[model samples]
Target: MSGSTATTTPQTTIRIPAPAVTALRDALLRPDGRERVAFGYCSRSGNDLLLTEVEQVPDENHRHSSPGSCRPTTACEREFISRCTSRDLHPVFFHSHPFTDTAWFSTLDRQLIDRFRKWLTTLYPDRDLLFGVLGHEEMRIERVTADDSRPVAVDIKGEWELEQPVRPTHTAAPDAPAVDTERFDRHLRAFGEAGQTKLANTHVAVVGCGGIGSILAQTLARLGIGKLTLIDPDEIEVSNLPRLPGCTHGDVGQLKVSAMHQRCWEANPDCDIISIARPVQETEDYLKNADIIVAGVDRVTARYWVNQFAVRHLIPYVDAGTVIETSDADPPQIESMEVYIQTIVPGVTACFDCLDRGDPDQAYRESLDSAEEKAAVERGYIDADIEPEPAVIDLNQLAAAHTVSAVKRLALGTQPPVAFRKYDDVSGDQALLETHPNASCPTCLGNSLALGDSTISSAADQEIATAPLDDAALANPLEQTDRTTRDWFPPAVTAFFASDLAQHPTTDP
Candidate 1:
């Protein structure tokens, strides 16, 4: 378990929030040198399972306890199973082998798991049963089956030190490269060969395929990222030709994602690129599997939705935008031209809500129907035709580069990305500012943080649509999420992302 670096291609992965992992580690790896057990209730999102809650079995609840083996009382097991049933969550059992160097199930473990799996599956026939073992060197999880078991990668979100499961055979070797060493010779130096392989395994989702987003897609492809998911509901326009990479007059009227997909393919033929010609709100299933989200959107509502999704799923988010202000006069005199970049590491750094960047007025207007919007415009409540924001290619490229650099840090496990970066286009000056999570922020704290698919659904979007955006909402943009709770599915519930599972999922595992 403790060896040189390696890479894995596990089909199943379990994403645990930082706090839950910390709690489990502390409880299972006790100083007493005795075996300990904990149970995690998981929520499924595509092939990835998210640990929503952890329950540590106390010493009093153990029937037998020793350094080599331990067993939870039948009553204790039933109690936790009851909790899982109440919440309609899947159960994953974890235990520690304090005396062992590598983690593996013992004979006692096989007996206990067989007994528990039989009892649990009878109650929930379709659900998968998983067992985890934490040894002195590493932790491993396997899905229990009638005949045998298969490895399930354990990914700790918000904590980079703990590892994603690496395939037993693939170790780090700079001289022996998996990718085109000549094409990425420069990359291997900055990121070691293992890091280069990590890039080849990372999946990034670009939420807006306009301006900066188009640049991000092409750049990431050129950087040898293994997968890219491009999402946007817009088609190309004549005016967009200047900002969109690889777009020409002939490509006008085509979907932005399609254009970017073709452009990215030309950049890296080996990289897998998925094009979704729809709003990010309609593409939550795809977003769930993304290793990182790069949002370069201008709409407040779109940004809000992306931020909420990232926070709820504990995915790293890079939100970048350009701001151009002009003074109102006979001629509009330029006031400021700047770009801002925020790297949101859920449960660790500040989120979109922590910065209070949402515009309630715009979001409310966007939610209005055609008739209601026309009435409001006629009543002078809102503008009938809002002028488009000014944009320039140089500013877009600058923002895209900064955003990609943030993703590079996350992919390579080098260091924490900068919390916030600001560049003055006119002054040619840049600054990196530090930011902390807001204790009261609903998006990244107190709620939604690591809630995973529990916080998302078609119903959740309806909540965002119907939320009251009055003075109270203006004070806190995401306060409306308080009303968007999703009920856990019934025993026979269908997979929410079942329809979209045909496409390739993220390759982080």
Candidate 2:
């Protein structure tokens, strides 16, 4: 697994978490050589296709393999199938090209898939075995059928509790470029095929769904960025409607990502959008494949994390926000209004954190984590929340538009480095930051390690997802996972919880 790089999958994608793949790699790449494992978890999402959760089964004894081949021993096979029967999961066969960088279903592999698929599908005919091949530098996964193998593009999601994302997974065929030149006729005239293909193939990670974020998402969707990974933890509140598109009065209390997802799909149905209703800290893996990360978040701590990740992974990052300060001296006049957009390219430009390194005020504000700061307050460290800045849709839109323009130009290879920019509302002045990277700066200097070489430990630990023991789940390629966790829940289960709560109202008799 490596850092984020945007990619597209046709119809099927098997997503494994970074840690599971790391663990699997550690096991398979032991000083001893080639191995096979009844390794992962299996859960079905939609009726025919969606796989909401596919994890590495976390059992140690459930594997066997010999040196040049990955076929499981007869005893391990039967034991794995029996375990899957008990666990109630579908299984996928997982292995690797140990001796080489390129791996595929050799005649032996196809035979193994055929035999293993028959062994289980004979009992549960509706199930088929999905096989995956991991190589030294790349990986591929496919759904195997009786006569043909359909490549199930491999993806990795979860809180990336490791140095980088799971290794990049390559599929056989990516989607054809959008041929509706008539739709983008005007844009075609402006940027041409090189620009068109770049936009079509690029993935942008949107890190918020607030005023600026919402606008950015909608605008980018309309512009046809091929894939979008939208991350935000807030739900739609009544106040959000005034500033965010795709947010209605009816959307109140629903996840912001939900609204963004619906809006993105509506704008461009052909685009692939994955909505993660969580903060960037919890879902950094999504950023692993993102070509550009557009952040519209309000929290400085979260932004700091993004800054660190972007530099560490060598991903381009852009963040922008708007603010209005009002004075209550008699008439409550607007004191100052401003918006800023900052762009950071790992080795090319100054890092966002550099701005805070010299100033105590800025550094303090950047260091504050609302939740952690709240805890600190209880321990008597801080006195107040960050001052609330009024937001206007107009201001938000302006900031988003400028950032979007910068992105479009950058993608088309025409924009210069504008590390930071400020627009003054009162004076109607635009300012560009001209600071150079500090020679000793951590993000872009000589000491800054290249992508994936940073020895920093993870911000969080990988929580093992618990699933029941199923024969099919045991036979899968990756690992087992249940969607019914405190942080993540399937829609059906969410609805059930709501209904259950309503029915079991606490009555004081």
Candidate 3:
């Protein structure tokens, strides 16, 4: 994946879909005591490197293999590269060392990487390369640039656990003191210091600082979440005072996120809160870094956009909403009151599109320019006056509570990562429904899944495409380096494996 490399030290994080993780383990970690190779395709979005698909090399096609040496047939390597270039995706090379539990690149591994890097640069000068060494217990990834290869964070997007030994180079703020407060004594007692620490290290983005969102922000703060980002564009109204937290008649015209920020600080003064008083679309850079996203917006259009964003970036998203339907009779009477919470674990769970819950028409109308929207309204494509939806604080609270519970489960790994629950006030019962993602979902499957920043058109893409190449690695990403004394295997073996394959002509998949 090649893009505009950050002038600042780039902190790269790798996100692999759950199924791709399974495929890698099953294909490369065979019971037989021998090394194996595989390849995957990925995209670079901002600081994230997302893997979308994985392909294993069949044993019959290997040119050579042993406990410490492995190499795919020349055809296999060429085919993999072809597929990646054809799809505008980057190739991620993987090799497993079943002999050990710890993973690190060997001298031979570096040699092979450099050869491929030099070869690929000749084919596509601006392209980037990624190489990984997989061990039984841990994995190591190297981000190949024109100048040097550095370690990057490799995190699985779903429930399956993978240990990443190398940490990315991202500066973190000072440790939060919220978890050590006397106010969270009971909370610490419930989950222990380690759990509290996990919450403290987490950063959550709560979109839509309205009834449910305000409650979520305050509750997350009180629960010791170290960082909170409150996002919304609306201002408080007289009608919103009852449902909004820390709001009064005097603050009726202020931005909802500002009031929610104050409310969260009062709940836990040590918690860091950022108020983004703008539409969610304009805040992708902030949202991409969040460990979790909580969507509390009222419209399906907004929810749909959030879901799409979450799926593309492989961010966990929790969606919460409340519905209060009333009869349009002489004297309106309540028909139903319901609270719903859906937890989306990117590749692991069903998305808004899979659930068929998003209104494409409404989303389209919202995406239109003001004049276009007016034309649409005049054309009878949408309602000229959309009546305000009925909302009650009690129901919003119930939704917020459930949504927070889902967030807790995700943060603590206390349960399955996926959930869809509903509470019906009239029926006096709650139901937990199973979610199944559509096989053909455009948002969370195939080419779009885990595409990262490249999935959306942006100025960065143009910058990367036209940026001047400043280093030879930009022309040839991997570097050929000297051998080390700590070779796990003989140098002769590594040399044969690295040079023998490149001699053959390239072939297509």
Candidate 4:
């Protein structure tokens, strides 16, 4: 009678079907001998590993051949996880190392293991899972339990027993609505739908297809932007994948514009994707057709060029930049992620020249000068000689995102941020929207902020006198200086003074 009262415990053994393993092997062997293996596990009770839900390790190829190096690709990882989630499968990824016999895991390998354990614990603390790390000839298995104890190895009958290729299910592509459908549907019913329709009709142009530009293009595409024009002269590089969205290791060496076009189209086939694989200077004509232009460039020279084009064509240009400086500590720490966003609406707010001058080197020098001396000057200084260093991708992307948000605000006819906005280092996040009434700015001369009557009259007089008096006039240096000063000074000075000149005229005039 006592023996008849035995109780049963739940079994935790995970089974990976045989057919799935074969498919994974085939997939890993494709694209010549270079292809690598990756897999995911799915389970309902949140304990058994579902081999049907597998994924290719992101950035796995780089460290695949090495013992402990790995760089995961975000797009690939996201794609893998999304597909699995859609099928109601939990994620447990598998990747291979090319080494034949590496007993100890490398730093990268340990880091990856640590990351996976942490992620699983955070997402599913009650679920037990297993992570597999396959070597060139040996397979290693590590089991993760609900408790934070050491992972133990489990022996399988065969190495390739659970290898199977799982293809992503095909579904009809969803329509991209212009508006914020998620938030709208969640909040307002009819108005949100209507707003989305309006958003679908907007078009955007991104200038610069490097790190920031590429990511911006993808974001806009995914957000269901109606039309997009991507411009860039450089080709993709292997190093760009770590930062740029929609790009893979395979995309390296391809034209950035072309890659972006392909990727955007893939993301939202209905959205228009135009490619301009040339410098912005060469594609000025195309820019006129855009409703909004985003400048995700590195050079101040390029920014100035964009500024001129945007001003001339009355296009809303959003300029973004990042300045990264390391501290002088034993282990250098990034001083700050100095992200900046400038929205230039031709006749609305202060243009780039009105916010601040384009020369960052000059700004840096000014920052270093004695505070008393720097403050004593009435007219702001200009460093015609300062050349800024090349900008990096993180700063560029952050700035681009800010610029896109600003554009969205403008497109929606919301109160756009004041004309000139600067997010200097983090502390300077305040929006400054001052306008210049008497600004003799070469950039915005005929627009919202007109030059003073005296400045205009002076300019007219100089133009008439220097109006090409035949070859004899060209021989005088004074004539050259006069013409050059007239043409360049107002713009240069306007940039230095920002919107301050609108309050009071420069005494020098």
Q: What is the lDDT of residue 416 in candidate 2?
A: 58
- The alpha-carbon deviation from the true structure for residue 297 of candidate 1, after best TM-score superposition, in angstroms, is 0.7
> For model 2, what is the error of residue 42's alpha carbon versus the real structure, in angstroms, after optimal superposition?
34
Please provide, for model 4 over 318-414, each residue's C-alpha lDDT reduced to its tens digit, 9 standing for 90 to 100. 8766777777797867666577677766544457776556787643454455664355443455433444443566566667677767766655443
Q: Report the CA-based lDDT of candidate 3 relative to the real structure.
A: 0.77
Best by lDDT: 1
Q: Which stretches of candidate 2 lie over 4 Å from their true place?
A: 1-176, 357-380, 384-387, 446-449, 453-509
lDDT, model 1: 0.79
Model 1 misses residue 408 by how many Å? 1.3
Model 3 regions more than 4 Å off: 1-11, 85-88, 114-126, 145-149, 160-178, 364-384, 455-509
Task: Report lDDT (CA) for all predictions.
Answer: 0.79, 0.65, 0.77, 0.55
lDDT of each residue in 371-476, candidate 3, tens digit only: 9989989999888867889898989999999888988877776566437998898777888987756788877765456767663333344444445544542332
Model 2 C-alpha lDDT versus the unseen true structure: 0.65
Q: Rank the candidates by lDDT, best first.
A: 1, 3, 2, 4
Considering summed lDDT, which 10 consecutive residues are worst modelled in model 2? Answer: 456-465
Highest TM-score model number: 1
